[model samples]
Target: MESSLVLEKYAEKNRFYREITEKILSGKTLNFEEALRLYQEGDFYFLGTLANVVKENLHQKRYYYTINRHINYTNVCTTNCKFCGYHKKPGEKGGYTYQVEEIIETLKSTPELKEVHIVGGVNPELPYEYYVELIRKVRENFPSLRIRAFTCVEIDWLSKISKKPVEEVLTELKQAGLNSLPGGGAEVFSERLHKELYPKKIGYQRWLEIAKTAHRLGIPTNATLLFGHLETDEEIINHLLTLREAQEETKGFYCFIPLAFIPEGNELSYLPGPSALKILKTIAISRIILSNFPHIKAYWVFLGVKLAQIALLWGADHFHGTVIEEKISQSMRKDTVVHLSKEEIERLIQEIGGEPVEI
Candidate 1:
């Protein structure tokens, strides 16, 4: 694809192809759709160059890494959203909630880990006090560890259950040592497509509102798009815009994670998997459009190692976690070993010529 094709395709978009080609040759920001088009049409040379330039520019060939552990505080979710593989039904054998002692025991043992990523089901029965006390106790016990916990969905559910304003709950959590919010459950942010995938769950706009509220209240949060699962190009653009608008308003979104939908033992079983090209295009486009956020992550667990490595050049700056016990999404795909050890994670980041930086 020539420079003109991208410019013509994204005429009104602030960062068009002509500007992108000029920037590429002169070394500036990338053109979003041109990169998307490259992913669509397989422009290897262009994609490779983009990755190398962006990666080197970001870190100068140095990859930073951190050791972290994943602890599912609980798994009993009432909003058993179809796309999720983690939620446990009432009578299901695996339905269990973590006692305060269990989570404390797990945290105390892992002294080497610097971060704790906590996310689980939207179980209304799990009292709001469980979360508040958990954060307070964890912070009091391990003052050094950064607690990157909770999804926007969890915050929404918790607030509604507690009958308190969103800001007040977040304020209490922050005081108790809540660090950041994860970008999970953003499964494709289109009104039409979201209804098909997660009709029973909270609205997509509610997710954005909570995320925005978190950022404004001094909490940094990551956002994601679960693409390649019955969504169209128009849907993708719309999703990006919603996130972009939030970024513009709060300037607190830390990264944009383009998640590849896993289709094993799930509702969308017959859907074909997304190709590497499609994945890379989405990543590049995310980086280009969500220009306000600093990092565009290429998550290894969801996309697999090979694609994540290749995506380093396509405007992706971060390769998300060094999860010791990542099991939720892994349950969806029988063959995937969801938990990636720190060393294994470093190997992949180093292989791609990108440094994994610690928070």
Candidate 2:
């Protein structure tokens, strides 16, 4: 259907939605207040339709996925964020760290792997050489593979451990064949939430500094937001806008991923996680706000396969990847699968009338 006809059909009854729809159709960027209003008051279906329009304008129904493997190198973390269930305190039982060779062997076992995602806890025990060696060996063995490793949080920890500036640390890692940084640990950009939820982790300014540094050095990274916790609507929109401002400067963020908060085994388990409607609304709002971003991911690991599929039409273009193993979410929800086959991924995208583009 034409954009005007679609808008007329779904949004014409409400002037607020109709005006917003017209503004989106005309290619005008939404201000922070406009985005917050759309997220707070616009009809859910109207939001989805308008977000899909913006998505189609950019990607034209191409849904991206990757044949990637996630390797959580260690679970012994010192930064004990209340929302996390994956970390073990230092020297705690069940805390495990992978040797460089073990990671290589795991890669050897998987066939047709295009990318290797490596992330883990802030282990003070491991020397800085461990990280460099891990990256160097992975690059040596899988010369063609893409290595997306470490979050800004982990990078900050590495800087402290190595006694090197973040720039030097990222330079050494990039030289050792780190392809990009994953978007984790950037739960929310609000200082209130930072102090309340994850006081040990790096604050938003430092996180953006590290990310912008990576961008300046020619390394692309993804951005993420962890919602459904103790964040208000204004805080969420501000987070997206802050990222948008950063992207305007660096253009380094390759994708924006809205991660649904999973409140299962964490300290905040008493609070129920975000509902499906909340998830879809956030994803759509993320697409509308982060115009500088090229892709929005409905990370299937947290959203579950079905909702992630629905998210494709609601403004998400990335179905994440065939994550061979993801220990973080699995630690919280026992039923979370460690892997999804390529056939299954393709079928899910096809069922939603999306063409899967393997990255």
Task: Using lDDT, give the best candidate's number.
Answer: 2
Clashing pairs in 1: 51-313, 63-355, 63-356, 64-355, 64-356, 64-357, 65-356
RMSD of 1: 4.5
Task: Report the lDDT tens digits of candidate 2 across residue range 137-198.
Answer: 99999999999999999999999999999999999999999999999988999999989989
Model 1 agreement with the true structure over 1-359: per-residue lDDT tens digits: 54235434443444543455456545543344644454455344444454444544555665544577777877788776666777787667877888877888988787587888888878866889999998888898889888988898888888988999998999999999999998887777777876777876777888888888898889999998988878887678778877877887899998788998887767777878688878887787676566666788878778887788777766787776677677676677766655666777777877765566665
User: What residue pairs clash in candidate 2, if any at all?
Assistant: none
Range of the 10 consecutive residues with the lowest summed lDDT in candidate 1: 2-11
Segments in model 2 whose C-alpha atoms lie over 4 Å from true places: 1-4
Off by over 4 Å in 1: 1-17, 23-48, 51-56, 62-64
The lDDT, on a scale of 0 to 1, for candidate 1 is 0.75
List the global CA lDDT of all models. 0.75, 0.92
